[model samples]
Target: MTRVFSERSSTRATRRPELEAAVKLAGEIRSSDVAVTLVVHEHKWLGRGTELAMLTEELKTSDVGLEFLTGELKGSHGPSGIVFTVLAAMSGMEREYLRDQEVSLRDIATGAKKGQHSSPATVMRMLREHDEQAATAASA
Candidate 1:
């Protein structure tokens, strides 16, 4: 049992760096407004956790358009069985936005779209705007 457990634990630990890298990469990609598929392909070995983390962090700041795609990564598929619940908090805002008005998900999606050449501040501002909208709506 001890040997089995250690082996399993070791496997989990080995994937951590990959997951971290993927998360960081996803965050970078989200900020850029570049399609994640393009970004994922450009960088080989972007582990699921890292990508998920990046998306989660990015969504935390703005309205992440591809929630379904992000949801796909939340299950046991990722390395080390890491889940993507970190993004759930964003869903509430997403849901509220969808419920309140005739807003198109496409528009919100487009609103957060960043050009491949956009600056980090631009991405940060977009995320901030999404958060501000959500906060204001919640208060009202």
Candidate 2:
């Protein structure tokens, strides 16, 4: 009963219209009770306007919802130096929460490396601990 969403920007054209369109689409999807996320890539050789137009058209009637993930490889760079960027959007609040927790866990793990000792294993352990805490907090 939850929704998650995300976006990815292409480097081909970082124009305002395209960015706006993407943001608008994201907002619309998120407002509809879908959790939203975004990722942006840089592609300077492509026309932002054209790309935006194409994306706008493509996403006009999407119903399953979107979860945008950036940096996913779609294809190789073409002769024109054009690169294919991938955008993945998922729908669901539970998914969103889990995603957020994973992100936080990663951050904690990374930060812990600076001085404290923490590994992915430790992070997972902490996540479980926090989950229990959360459940306790909710019950109270």
What digit string (tens of lDDT, one per residue) describes model 2 on residues 1-140? 33223234333323445555655766677568665443433222122223433443344333222232232322333212212222211112222443465644343322322223222223335667989999999999
Task: Please list the Cα RMSD from the true structure of every candidate, rounded to 1 decimal place.
Answer: 16.3, 16.2
1-140: candidate 1 lDDT, tens digit per residue: 00111112221122445444444555576577754421121111222222333544454454223222222232222211122242333333443444355555554343332222122223335568989999999999
How well does candidate 2 score on lDDT at residue 122? Answer: 35
Reference-based TM-score, model 1: 0.24
| CA lDDT of each prediction against the hidden true structure | 0.36, 0.37
- Give per-residue lDDT, candidate 2, residue 123: 38
Misplaced by over 4 Å in model 2 are: 1-15, 42-140
Residue 21 C-alpha lDDT in model 2: 60
* TM-score against native, each model: 0.24, 0.22
Clashing residue pairs found in predicted model 1: 22-50, 22-51, 23-50, 23-51, 33-114
Per-model clash counts, in order, read 5, 28
